[model samples]
Target: MKDEKTREAYWRKNLSYLAILLSIWFIVSYLCGIVFVDQLNTIRMGGFKLGFWFAQQGSIYVFIVLIFVYVRLMNKLDKEFNVNED
Candidate 1:
């Protein structure tokens, strides 16, 4: 019973982190790329439009960084919750 409770809590924590990471990803890409594109385009980056840069390259880089961040945070969370695989 206690084990099941711990497992459930662990999942809830992990899912919350997942949701947050995904929301940030969406905001940085979809919201910034399509919604505020014109406003962003006003800013130039090495001859590349800001919106275009984000749509093409910036978002990918952010996603990569997000992945690393998630991994690092998840590891910490796992340790905190005593569920780390290692």
Candidate 2:
């Protein structure tokens, strides 16, 4: 069995990373798309306004990137904690 310290450390690392990544996701989607939309609309991406792009496409891309980041980092973490699946 793993020691308490090791288990606690593993959970702490996992939770902290999860919180940080999710916070970033929330900020980019909500803050940029809704809160600062007017400011973002001042910038254009191709034919679409920045705010619209973010609302329709940018956030989706960011979410995909976040998923990859989580998968890659958690895979590394799992290896470090010797909990990785075969």
Candidate 3:
């Protein structure tokens, strides 16, 4: 880093990204999968209750998507901060 201020900004942006992504994962896995399970169960998906699917598989799928999202966001952030390897 060229200076302390730039390094701090980069770390701050990275932490913000982590916090946002983790919150999304928490909402999907915990709120949708467990807390709102009964309400979600009213709907069906692929022969399984929506809640059950979320509790079993949907969260996993969302997590995978979020992983890609985080990677993409980080790549952009890296380029913005001129820290990208490329």
Instruction: For residues 1-86, write the lDDT of model 3, one tens digit per residue.
Output: 46888889999999999999999999999999999999999999999999999999999999999999999999999999999999
lDDT of 1 by residue, 1-86 (tens): 99999889899989999999999999889988889899999999999899989888888899999999999989999998887898
List runs of model 1 lying over 4 Å from the truth. Answer: none
In model 3, state the lDDT of residue 67.
Answer: 97
Question: For every model shown, what is its TM-score relative to the native structure?
Answer: 0.90, 0.92, 0.94
Worst-scoring 10-residue span by lDDT in model 2? 1-10
Most accurate candidate by TM-score: 3
**Distance (Å) between predicted and true CA of 4, model 3?**
0.8
Summed over model 1, clashes come to 0
How much does candidate 1 score in TM-score? 0.90
Which pairs, if any, clash in model 1?
none
lDDT score at residue 82, model 1, on the 0-100 scale: 89
Please give the distance, in angstroms, between residue 59's alpha carbon in candidate 3 and its true position after superposition: 0.6
**Higher-scoring candidate on TM-score, 1 or 2:** 2
Better of 2 and 3 by lDDT: 3
Off by over 4 Å in 3: none
Sort by lDDT, best first.
3, 1, 2
lDDT of 3 at 73: 96
Please give the clash total of every predicted structure, in order.
0, 0, 0
- Per-residue lDDT tens digits for candidate 2, residues 2-78, read 58888999899999999998898888899988989999999999988999888888888999999999999999998
